[model samples]
Each structure stands twice: as structure tokens, then as C-alpha cells.
Target: MNYITCSQGHKSTGGSNFCSTCGEPLQNSNHYLEPTLIGIQPGTRLRDRYIVREMLGQGGFGRTYIAEDTGRFNEKVAIKEFIPSVQGTGALNKAVELFQREAVTLYQLQHSQIPRFWEAFQENSRLFLVEDFIEGRTYESLLNERLRQGRCFSEPEITKLFQDLLPVLSYLHNQGVIHRDISPDNIILSGKTGLPILIDMGAVKQVTVNVATNLQTTSAPRGTSIGKVGYAPDEQIRLGIVAPNSDLYALAVTAIVLMTGKQPEQLLDQYTLTWKWDREINLSLLMTQVLNRMLAPRGDQRFQSADEILSFLGLRQTNPAYSTPNYSGNSTPIYQNPAYSTPNYSGNSAPIYQNPVYPTPNYSGNSAPSPVNNSGCGQIFDASIPVPQEIKGWNWGAFLFGAFWSVGNKVWIGLLCFIPYVGLIMAIILGIKGNEWAWKSRRWASIEAFKANQKTWAVVSLCLTGFVFVIVFLASLGGS
Candidate 1:
């Protein structure tokens, strides 16, 4: 039997005109006739390293090929070719430039849940990117299989799925790169690790660049938006403005699709431009609320970050000290630890640092710190709580202001404010040693100068607390 490869690189034994797997035309006669539209043929060697096996898929922008890396123990790799359907040499040059620039960023990305980028090169007038070949089916295939079984994903399964995948999105956002297209089709479930791997970074279309350039020259609209319809938000589809929250919106839509076993278009109300999910889906109230927050039509109303969603799910603790590292260009990649230690508050003791000057007064190294109430006022006048008396220890101002406090006082611990509960912990520490931290972190000309600043911060904190109480009381009275 003669074997033929489909456009999706699936091998079929029967000699049919159309591929049995992907339903793509298998005959060379039916392929695009343009000389420029040809894909690298199977068995063709490029750069004396990669041997092309078959065309995986093609879109308006590029073609993906399954290839074998001869230099790397015959490891299979996915090679993407930049072949935009544009006629002019100028258009082709612009596309190649964009591809090259984006390739540099892609190559630097190193994550377990993402395909590792190997190399990028130009050969035979075509730009190509090589990355690790993920041996798994896309989420799209999994959804279809589940639907065939007459079942949709359960709430717990969807929650677990998002928990596993949200970190990948968080990692990407930390690198300042947004996965503009985050549909089920772009996510592949790793057969080896059983993890969802993000693919198709190329879906971030160059429409923004093209439009900006065109406006500078002729004020003409140029290039089409690059994203899957229904998955992408109105901001991205209409204005081409994408942010980390935009990916969250897509993730929420993916979850809804998996839960309902319906296409995004099917679940969405065309007129209202909102999801029309049936109310009887037996989902937990917490999960439902999280999904609603994530799917809020306005970007601002949506959960601002993946960390916030994780916190809402009770999977992660608030870390006030964690700062996501920038990974753009030549910057070193910062690895973030998802797990965090909860604050220890069980006995009358203070936290001792490595520095002897910052040692707690009665900490025996065995006794645990006394538990303090979360109520703002309880933390202030609780005499049973051991407060650090060091003049220059932890700053309450830094805790309340968080990153701003760190910047103001030149204390690095302020970065932890980015973590949810870390700020509260820092604030508690500051309540004990705010004056000390403020004094040490600043360059005051005199002790009096430091004392005055601390006094001011104390007054400010008190005023803010009272103001909050007044607002709450007024709102309660209005409700009554």
C-alpha cells in the first residue's frame, strides 16, 4: 500500500486523493501552484541539520513542518517557515524582519510547559524557526474525544486544568510576551508529562506593526487581526490591544467550552457579546464566581493577574515579597516558586533575621511567634504580642505602601508586596519595627528627622484606618 502524508503530517496507508485524518488534499496537483507558495518537500535537508519530514499545517502567515534534527541525536523538531501571502518584495522584507525579531524572544523562552526554541535561520530565501516537537494532541482533539463520549469536563477537572495551565500564562506574562491566541487549538496536552504546553506564539499577528507603519506613510489601514474568533476579547479583535488579562479571558472561554462541550460561537450571545451559559450546570458557586470574574466583558473588571485567580482558588498564598522578573531581550530569566510559606504566629516571639542587630528581644529560638488577629485595631494595642523595639527594623509604611514603600525607603523587601498576603505580613512586621526599618532604610541627617517621619506615617495609617471605617459605616447605613 502506498503511504501518503496529509497537510497535518498524518500518514495514511490508503492511496486516496484526500487525507483520511485531516481531510486535506493529498495530491500534489491540488496543491498551491505558486512557486513562492511551495512548502519544503519531505526528505529535503535544510542547514545540513534538519531533515524535513512533512508539512504539519499552513496559515496565512506561515507553514509548520515536522522535521528531524540530525545534529541532536535525530530528535524530532517542529520548523515554522515564514511565508506570508503578500506579493510585494517590501511586504516580504517587513514580514521577515518581524519574524526574526520575534524569533529572538521565542528562542530565549525556557519553560517546562512551553516548547523549547532551538534555533532560527534564513535558508533559500525563507525564514525558519526550530523548536522542540511536542508529541501530543491539541486540546481541540481532546474536547472532540470527550464530546464523542457524550460527556463534558466536570467543574473539578476544569479547575485543575486551569490551575496547571495558569502558571504557564503567568510565566509568559512575566516575560512581557502575551499569548494573543490562547484557544484550545493552540494548547497541546503533553503525552509524557500530562501537562498542557502552550504553542503557536506566531499567532500574535503583525497587524499592529503594519498599521503603525502604514499610518506613518499613507494613513491606510493594513493587515488583518491575528487571533481565533470568540477566544479573543473585543479589545484584541477590534483595537488590537492585548494584555495579560486578555489571555485570561481566552482561558475562561476555553474552560467554558470544555465544560459545555460547545464551540465558543455556540455558547456566546451574538447580540450581547457575552457568554450565554445555562444556569443549571451544577458548578460550585466559587468556581462560577471565578469564571464570571475572569469573563467580565470589561478588561478592568476582570482579575488583573493569574496569581489573583490562583489565590481565589485557594491554591496559592499571598506573597508580598515576590516580584516577577523581566525576561525581555538579554535580561536573565527569573524562575518563580509557586509555593509560599504561611506566616508563623503561635507564641510570644519575634522573627529573628541573620543579622544580630535585628534580633528579637525575647526570642529563645524555640518559642514560636504569638498569634495576632487580622483585625487592623487588634494588631495595634495587643500587649501580649511581642513587638520588636529596634529603632531601625521593619517599616510599617513599607508594608502598607508595599512596592512604593520599598522605593521610598530603598528597602528591597517592598518587592514582596506583589504577593497577596505578603503585604499584610510585612505590615505586621512593620507594626513591630516600622521605625527601625524606616531609620535603617533611609539616610536621615539626624535621629529627630527619622522620628518625625515615623510620627507622620503613624498618623497617616491611623487616618486611613478611620476613613475606611467611616466609609463602611456609611455604606451599611445606606443599605439599611
Candidate 2:
């Protein structure tokens, strides 16, 4: 029968041996199965070792399987089946190349976080790669579990998580390897190791030609633009350049999601309005500030290296405790509620006064004698009163009238300028200086004419509007 049911329990039928829909083997029976090896079947064992068990997951490019080794080996492995495209010859060839290249890249990797690659071979035109099977959950699963508990991850949990990932990225960057895809799902939590193991180096590329033997370097950078959309940085989404800082940007977004238990999309919208650290997070202020900077829209504004982030976290370098001075009347920390109050300058003592010295007056002259010490109810000149200065400019009444006059003149100038053809050019020139000449001069002249009447200000907005209309009219007529 040229038909088979996928591990997803979906039925597929076609001429090609691979499942027409999911690209799995079409042979569904046993005993008389098409091919066989060591109690297993053919079209199943790629390198005569890995035994294809069942499907774990599938994406647009490839399908992952939970397979086991049967050839003198008893270990579970993940077989990533890269099915050649039956549609286009060019695409089939390119997919095959990418599959082989990815295997080679994985083979060259030497990090504990990265899965170890065993072998790469073909089974009836279908490429399969065997890699270490990470047993546990993905970061996405962990996030969901945290959410289900009605609790969000704490800052320390997030910091420890990223701190562990930073070394992996730092190592890759030093080797000129850009992961190109750093999302929560790609990060697998290893139950045995109790740490995140970065998986699926299929999209990984060597921007530098260090270990890659058959590397293809183009004027274009040698990494995939295929990253988780929301977590992907703006540059990576818009332009396909994969720099080390790009990873930092994604990691920052991941950290935010982990801390807030919010999807990247929700956080991104809030971030567009204004990005700031979660007040609930208890990490160092500098570290939070650094994460905020990492998510900056402009890549140039972001930090250059993971080491910078590490240093800000007080891991790679020493960061001095910077205490800001208290600006509020309270001297307590700004983070505190109902900030502390400043101490009063005076204690409980009332202010004391000195005895006054009065000027003696000539009683014999027409001038009255200065009052004697008035302790006994004699009339007293108000000692606490302040004397007003004499107005040097025009009186307040005169100043007000002059302002009214100047405003009237401004209106007249506007009416005159609104005459039509000549008005446009005249308005253009005077519009440039309308406030500078007419309205401003009135205010200046008013201030000059009446210091006491300085409080009286001519509302120049009406004058300015009138002046603009006049100038426009003049320009229109002049053009005609």
C-alpha cells in the first residue's frame, strides 16, 4: 500500500515512500515491511544505528522524532528527518545542502549547552541527523507551568537562567557562531543536568569561516533570518544581519517575558510606549537598566557584548554602589513609601528680638517729635511694613491707555496690510518679524514707559493673528 498514517494520527496517501503530508515513511505494516534491520525496519535506520520510533514534532522545514539506537547501543536519540522537497528541484537541492551543513556545524560544536551530534546520512533520498535526546521540558512549557501556578518567575530565577545562557553565547560569539534563533522554545531544560540545553543548531551558521569546511560566505551575512518573530530584534526582522548583540536583544526580551509572565507581544506594545524595569523585580537597578538598554530599537544603542551585561549584573566586573542624593524634603530612599521628612532647622525656641533705636526729632522745629518708647499705648508707626518704590515710568493709568493705543495701532497695521496684491509679500516679511517688531515693541515700550504698570500686558495673540491675515492678503494681491 502506498499510504501511511502519521505519528500525529493523520492519514496520508501518495506515490512517494515518504508521507505526503508530514513526510514520514509510507510503509505502515510489519514482517513483509519494505526493508528491515535487527528487528526494526528499513527506511527507518539511516546510519544502521538509530531506530525511528515515533514523531515528536514537525515544523515547516523538518520533523523531529523520538528514536532509539539498536546497533550494539541502547540510548535514546532525536532523529531530525530533513525530507527533500518533491515540489521544486532547486528547493530540494538547497534543503539537502542546509541539512548537511547544519549537521557539520553541530559536529564542530563543543559546548555542554549544545546537543552532541553523532552522525548524518541518507535513507532513500531523505536526510536524517542523530543527536542527543534532551529529556525534560522546553522553556515554553516551564513558562506555562509557572503561569498555571498563578505565580510569575522571580528576578533571581530569570537572572540565573540568562547568566547560564550568557556563557554559551559568549563562547559562540568568540567562535563567530550566531545562534540566529534564541527563543524560549529552542531552549530545552535537561532533567539530568538541571540546566538549559540549546537545541536545533539547524538554523545556526558560522558568520566567520573558522571550523566550517564547505562554508558559503556571501556579501550577505552567513546566518538565517528565521527566528521566533516576536522575540526577534527589529534589525533581524527587517534586515537579515545576525550579530552577537542580536542574541542579546532576544535574550533580553526572553528575560522580560520570564520575569513578567507576559508574552513578548504584550511586552513589546508596553515597551513601545515606555520601557522600564518591573518595579517588582528585586535585582540590582543597574542590571534592570542594562536590560532596558538591550531592548533599544536601534542596535547601535544596545550593548556590544554579553560581557557588558555580565559586568552590569556584577558578575564579570565590579560595579560600585551608586547612591543618589535625596531631592525630596524626605531623606529616605525614593523606593520607600511616604518618604522620610527633613528635620526642622529650629528646635522648640521662639525667635527673640533686639531693642529698637529711634531717631530723635527737633521738637522746636515745625516737624513733630518722634514718638517716645510706645510700651504704654501711644500711637506707633508700623515698623514691620515695607515701603513701595516710586514709579519711574508713566503711571499705571497712563500705561494701560498706551497699551490699548498700541494694540489699536497693531489692528490698524493688520487692516492696512490686508489690502490684497501687495499684502502677501509684506505679510511674509512682517510675519517673520510681526511679534518681533509690532507686538514686542509695544510690550518693551510699555515696560519702558511704566515700570509700575509692568503687570499690564497686551494680549499679543490677537495682534499676531490680525498681522498674519493682513500679510497673507497682501501677498495674495501682490501675486495677482
Candidate 3:
């Protein structure tokens, strides 16, 4: 009897229209639609390792397939085929080159939140990239499900999401990469961890190199605009200028969509170019401020980095040395009861400051102080209180070196030194209180090490300043 295999590779006894085991359509599975471009037939083995099962989806540049890794216990993987819709041999060659570049870049990324890149190869006159198959529903699907239930995501859910995904964005930014496409469809809520996994590297653009040289040598391919409409910011969609904040803008749009259960087009007014939300939703002012900054129309107006957002939310990177409170024997969790004070890890527990939004971890005397509590406070900085000890309160090094001091210590706020008037003001403020801000922004091994490091930066800045002065003086004398 002639048998038919389903998309999941389950073989039915006879040539039935539907799969016997999976119940998926024999001709076309409900999991994925048929490919529109060039693709491999189901059950075809490529590179003698990956067995293509079905086309997962297709885009302007390529088709993705659900494949099985024959070499690794028949584990499922996704294979991306580089088959751009552009015509001619030249276009195909360029497309292949771009595809290979993307694969190589992706291969180097070893983040837990990103898909694991397995291999990239050319077979049967086609290029393909293999990556770990994430078994989870897309955020798009989750949003749709919520909509069906007639309820949208709550404020706490959105806050938790931001906390989870911001680190992933921070990782990518630190690597000098920008994810040009960041929509709800590209995010997968992991079934195992319940954390968001960023997918679809097709739209990833390198920020450190000349992107035009690689992909837009002649003219950009017809499908070069890689982001979804409304989700992508104005700078990215119209000018093709994608910055780190561009992804944040898209993320903000995704959050709004999740909260409202409405499409981006519905929330945004095309004429005025601003977002609109129902007053009945009742989001806190802090969340409103954060989302507004993230969704700023201009990239410069938005928070430059994910870390900035985290700082605003009063969340800090957990120090590996510090362990969470042990709740082994207690039937009622200590964390659940607000009245219950955190047990002392050491003799000294820092004075507890309750944040209306998130639970603030009580640090012992041995551990570093937690991030500044900005939960109910509207101002970024208040002059009344002394700066936290973790960030050295005041230093002559920061005062003299100014922006240089901030940069050397990874106080990213120093980047604002490039701005005209605002930069001048920031430099002055950093000069006066740069050490305090830097300390709060980053973690240090010890106070002594941090002070020594700042002293060195001050010395360097002084020498550089003298050199510039001498050069200018010599030039002026020669001109006279």
C-alpha cells in the first residue's frame, strides 16, 4: 500500500488526506503553510544530516523548514533556505553572500535567550542554515489567545516581561549587533522556562560595520525592509537608520499591543503619529513613563540602552555571590507576606525600603547594596540623600576627567557628552557627581579597585587635554 508521511514525519498506513497519528493534513500541515518559493520536499535529507520535514514559513529572503538532525538522536531543528525572490545570477550571488554573513554572525552568538546555531551549508545549488528548534508558542499566538479570552495582559505581566527580555537585548547590544525586527511574532515564550526567546535573525543588522557594502552594494533587494509595519519605529521604517533604541521602540509597541489586545495600527494615530490607549486600563505612572520613553518617535529621545530601562525600574543585576533567602521549611513563603521582614543573612541587613511595584531584595552587610529605589520617586536624582556606597559618592577623578571618567568606568550616561547644550550640562554634572552615578550603574569588585581605576582615568584625561592645548597653541602661533 502507498503510504503518506505527515509534516511531523509520522507515516500513515495508506495515502490518506490527513495524518493518522498527528491528524495534520497530508498534502499541507496546519502547523505551517506551503512554501511560495524554492524549497525541499518533505523527507529530503540535506548535507547527509538534516532531514527536512516541512516548511515552517517563508519571507522575502528565505524559507524556514522544520528538520530532524539525523546525527543527533533525530532531534528537531529549523533549517533556513537562502532563496531570495530577486531574479538574475548576480542577485542570487549577493543574496547567498548576505545569508552566509548572517549565519556566521549568528553562529558566534552563544546566548541562552537566542536560538542555538548548529550549521550552515550549501547543497544542491541552495544555501541553508540549521538552528535549534524552539518548542514554544509565539507571542503573537499568546496575544491572540488572550484576546479570545477577552482579557489583555496586566501591568505586572508586562513589567515581568520587560525584566526578562531586557537582558537579552543588553547582550546583543554589547556585542555591537542590532535586531532590526523586534515584533510580537519574533518572540517565543519558552514552554519550559516561561522566558521570552528572541527568534528570526533574518533582520539582524551589524551596527559596527558598513551594512551597505554587504547587502546593498547596488540597490537594496525588494524585501530589504525587514521589519513589520507599525511595530518598527519611524527611523527604521522610513530612513533605514536602525539604532539600539529602534528595537526598544518595537518592544514598547509589542507591550502596548499585549496590554490592549489591539494591533499597533489601532493604537497609533497615523495622522498625529502618537500612541493612544484607553484611560480605563489604569497603568502606573512609572510604567507609563518607561513605555513613553521607549516608544519615543526619535531614537535620540528614547533611552539609549536596555540597562537604562532596568535602572529606571529599580532592578539590578543579581550578584552571584549573594544567595536568595532560603524558604525550605516554611509552608507559607516569607516573600508572599509583606509584613514579614527578610531574615538576616549576616548580622547587618540594610534598612528595608518598600517599592510599590517590585519586591526589593534585602542585602546583608557582606553583600553590596541593592540598586537605588526609584519606584515611587519621579525624579532621576534627588539632592537630599547621599549617594550609595557601591557607587563611590564623590571623587576628584570624575570631577576633573568629566566624560572620560564616565566612559572608562562604563557609566554609559557619558555617551550624552556628544549632545550640544545637553552634553555640556551632563558633562558638568558628571564632573561633579560622575563617580556616584558610575558606581550605581555598574558593579565593582571592591571600593579600592574602583578608586584606583578612576584615578588612572583622571591622569589620562589631564594628559590628553594638555596635548590638545599645546597643539592648538602651536597652530595659532604658526598662523600669526
| Candidate numbers sorted by lDDT from highest down | 3, 1, 2
> Better model by TM-score, 1 or 3?
1
lDDT tens per residue, model 3, 1-480: 555444344556554667687787554332222323446789787776777899988765567899999899999998877654443345445555655666655765777778999877754235577888999999899988988989988899888888888888876654445677788899999998788999985343221122333445554322234477998887556545555677888899889889988888888767767666533355765787687678766665677767779898987643222223343332221111111112222323322212222222322324432232222222225555344455445565665565666666667777787778877777777776776666444434345655777777778777887899999999999999
Candidate 2 lDDT by residue in tens digits, 94-212: 44555565555456667777788888765433557778889989988888898999887677777787677776776655443557678778888889988788886524222112113
TM-score of 2: 0.54
lDDT of 2: 0.52
| Clash list (residue pairs), candidate 2 | 35-42, 420-477, 421-477, 421-478, 423-474, 423-475, 424-474, 424-475, 425-475, 427-471
Q: What is the C-alpha lDDT of each candidate?
A: 0.62, 0.52, 0.63
Candidate numbers sorted by TM-score from highest down: 1, 3, 2
Worst 10 residues of 1 by lDDT: 334-343
Instruction: List where candidate 1 sits over 4 angstroms from the true fold.
Output: 1-35, 202-224, 317-480
Better TM-score candidate (1, 2) = 1
Model 3: which residue pairs collide? 391-439
Clashes of each: 13, 10, 1
Per-prediction TM-score: 0.58, 0.54, 0.57
Residues 1-480 of candidate 1: C-alpha lDDT, one tens digit per residue: 555544334555545676676777655432211224567788778777788899999887678999999999898999987654543445545555556656666765678888998887755345678999999999889989988999887888888787788877776766556677888888999999988889987332452245234323333333235567888878667755566677899999888888898888887778656565643254654676577667777665676668778887987522223335432343222211101111122233321111111111222223442321111111223344333342445445544555665566555665666778776776666555555544444434344555666666657766776899999999999999
